[model samples]
Target: MNKTLLGSIYLALASSIWGGMYVVVKIVVSVIPPLELVWMRYLVAMVSLLVVSFITRQKWRIHKRDLLIIIAIGIIGNTISIVAQETGTMLSSAQMGAIITSSTPAFMVIFARLILQERLTLKKGFSICLATIGVLLIVGADQVDLSSKLGGISLLVAALTWALMSVLVKRVPSEYSQIMVTTYSILVALIVLTPFVLPRLQAINISQLSHPAIWGGLLYLGIVSTAGGFLLWNRGLQMLNASSGGLFFFFQPVVGTLLGWLILGENIGLTFWTGSIFILIGVILVIKEKK
Candidate 1:
């Protein structure tokens, strides 16, 4: 199989998994604060990944050289970007979150140029713009408040840092398994989040967390979205460069909308279908160009 094709599949699947996360995140965050949700998310993911690593009989040793890069990946993407994303979602509307953070591919292109010196071909550039427009169309500026400046800024922060972290994944040596890399990085984030989240735990009604939805949401986020999604994303980036691979992130909202329509009986009109076409064309352009 072509590496680019496989990479594209991995990237698309990762984002699609996260698309269903919209409803779950809202439910979990209502019961758990932003930071604490992040902490617990990583905790669930770390434990899940570590168990997989052990079963796979993977080498656990990291060369001193790559340790810092992995740590940076964890802290930047897993910690900061997520913290900002959840916080921004809490402060702002989910529609706002989707529209703003979808800028990640553009930022990834910029960072790839700066950090990796990857050239942005004309095809790549146009596809990004088209997909971005598709995103805007799908999640139109309805009931959004620009007055929520803080939330907007936090989401922008999330986009920028996540982009940087995605680009940085290219720096880690390919000899290491992405599963291991993802697990270790998540562990790093878990350690960083523990202190802050611990103190705030007592204030929340602990009994509320025992609900099946809360526990189920956190587990899905940890095992499927975090562990599985991050590993697939990281592995895909290994096969494709950051600039091209990041385009697949656009699928998140498309999948979210699709799932909403299918599962939640959310209405999907012509605009939604039209936007889906744009996103598909954008993805196809990248895949063909990379090939």
Candidate 2:
């Protein structure tokens, strides 16, 4: 199969897995504290990826020159980003989290142009505007009272952190395999989450383990969302042009919105549809301009 076909398939699968992840997270968070859930999810993901790394005979060693960079990527890309995202979900609705996170592609474009000197086109500029409008419509329909302060701040932090991670990933040298980078980055995330794990462990009642929702959610997150989704995404990016690979992200919010309705029985109002239309338009415009 051609690289474009492979990339498209992989990206679609990644988005679907990610969409389902929101439902799983909602289920698990009911039983476990958000911090604990985050720690366990990454712990499982780390172990799974480590095993894959070993099986594939991927090198674990990094040059001294790249060690700090890898660590930074781990902290910012894996650790901080996940923390922000999960915490944001806990504080706000999953719909809000998904919509805000969709803005990452726009941020990625801006960061590429400013930091990497990549050319930006008017089509992409228009798409970014449309996406912003879509996000606003979604936020408005939700009737989010940012008067709470903390919830609003958390969502914004999640958006910014995810954007930062995207830019950081682009800065990494092509010589480093995406799998190796992802594995190392996840390992660091495990380390960063360690402190929270023990405290949560002490608080958990043994009875909670017997809850089907808890284990099922964790399994879904570890196997499907984190491991499978990420592996496919890395493969897709390897096969496709960077811009094309980035455009695939545009599907995430749409998938997320559908999943929200199917799983959570969340009401999708007119604003939701209108906002999605704008977001889609914006994404198409941006990619066309980039081309």
- On TM-score, the leading prediction is 1
- Please provide, for model 2 over 19-73, each residue's C-alpha lDDT reduced to its tens digit, 9 standing for 90 to 100: 6776677778777777777778777887888778788888666778877767876
Alpha carbon lDDT of each predicted model: 0.90, 0.69
The number of residue pairs in model 2 that clash at the backbone is: 2
**What would the TM-score be for candidate 1 when compared with the true structure?**
0.97
Count clashes in each candidate, considering only residues at least 3 apart in sequence or on different chains.
0, 2
Off by over 4 Å in 2: 1-9, 135-142, 234-247, 269-278, 281-291
What's model 2's lDDT at 86? 71
Q: Which residue runs of candidate 1 sit more than 4 Å off their true CA positions?
A: none
Query: For every model shown, what is its TM-score relative to the native structure?
Result: 0.97, 0.84
RMSD of 1: 1.2
